[model samples]
Target: MSRIGRLWNSLANPDRIPKLFAIVLGAVILIGFLIPLDLNVDQLYPRPVPQEQVEENISTAPYARGGEVLESPGITRAQYPENSKSLGWINSYMSPLAIWVASTSPYFGTSIYSSPGGLIDEILYYTRGFDTILESTILMMAFVIASWLGVNFTMNRKKREAEAAADKSKDYYDPTLNKNKTYYYNNQNSNIKEEQD
Candidate 1:
């Protein structure tokens, strides 16, 4: 068989299949958390709500300038959907969840994760960093478990080999010719000798 065939045979073994699946799953999770998807902001982002709605929703005091409510200009502010806003700033690459965490989180009292073209800056860098850490941890655990299983298999194989060798040696050279025939061979032999003598 070819090298590829041998490799496939080993991988297809039932004992190794679970370990292979774990490694693949870990890699996929790591990639999913690391790689950011490219998406259009206009399609995903919600329109800004008027300040009037904001005041009404929060039940906060109305803005007053010169004792005139009209002076506030009815400030218009961007409204970010719950758990999603920072995804708009797709600088180079950024994960959707990381962007969401950064956008929802407060930075300089603004909803955006960063300033200057809304680039994915420190906010995404740090937030996503945690996911990378978790992925690495899982990968490490898989490696350790696989290594341990390999060591155990090797040890068991060696032990069985040693036992087989001992059995063959006993069959070829037995100290007592009939020892294998009975569990109490030595006692029975002594009793027979005593009765005869």
Candidate 2:
């Protein structure tokens, strides 16, 4: 048989399957929290160039230099925008889910280049929104999972306890029951005593 087949056979047992699933799921969740998303939000539009600089360049003309667009830094590279025309970078420390949620808000979602009204508006509704949403989702999911496991565990424990109690109540020839209990006689007229404890 193949190695995979052997592994599956071993783990497929009723006793081991749940443990295997829990271990694999826990590892995935841990890695997801550790990994960071690669989000460079500079693909939206041409880099902004100030009109004053363009005018200044025209006044101090160099005959040899052709009229070419000057390279300027994109707004998204900055941690925060000073004015209305910056797209700003999302926090690097945020989880992937949080980043996705924050960056995909209505204002930031449709267009990362467009102004989000103001800095507070951008931060509250757009950038930091991911963390809020992710936290709520985690809490909700945890509540649901905990309730499910709790119910199953409680029911299984009760069932096992009831079965044990029922087994104890059964009338068996337990030698520990009573030392002076009378035993039924055989057809051959022999008084056979019950086995000693």
Candidate 3:
């Protein structure tokens, strides 16, 4: 057979093709991680919070400043330059959920975990990691399942078609002849021809 004919024959037999394909795909994902380039997203970033939005959210109270209520213009509230913001980020990875065991504030002794945004940011980061793993697992599983189902469906269809063809061949070979009735009719016809003679 030519190369094309050989390929066609192999394709006609698809029992292990899907399993082979799954192995290849898994290997590629495992080893084919390409480092991303061109990630300079800062060049396209529209300045952080826009001047008007920052101004609007700025402290409107009289004690904020004399003429300018905005200390840091165009900065987001998430990055509001408070005294604790830098300290909070430095201690984030350590016990990001709760930095201290005890608290002596008027807010009923709430621990470091009670600090706003500390716990939430850590949770979001780890949750994102878990989500990445889960999403990859689901995608690979889906690929395998879809390929297996498709191959099985094709095989069953081929089987049914083969059975139908065999049935058609059988019909052609057996042309509705009854053995006992044919023997009797043949003998009777010969006797009538002899009587006429």
Candidate of highest TM-score? 1
User: What's the ranking of the predictions by TM-score, best on top?
Assistant: 1, 2, 3
CA-lDDT, candidates in order: 0.47, 0.45, 0.43
| Candidate 3 off by > 4 Å | 1-47, 51-127, 160-197
Ranking by lDDT: 1, 2, 3
44-63: candidate 2 lDDT, tens digit per residue: 32233445434444321111
| Cα TM-score per model | 0.24, 0.24, 0.22
**What range of 10 consecutive residues in model 3 has the weakest lDDT sum?**
60-69
Q: CA shift at 124, candidate 2, in angstroms?
A: 7.7
Stronger candidate by TM-score (1 vs 2): 1
Model 3: lDDT to the true structure: 0.43
Q: Where does model 1 exceed 4 Å of error?
A: 1-38, 42-125, 163-197
After superposing candidate 2, which stretches have Cα over 4 Å from the reference?
2-7, 14-125, 147-197
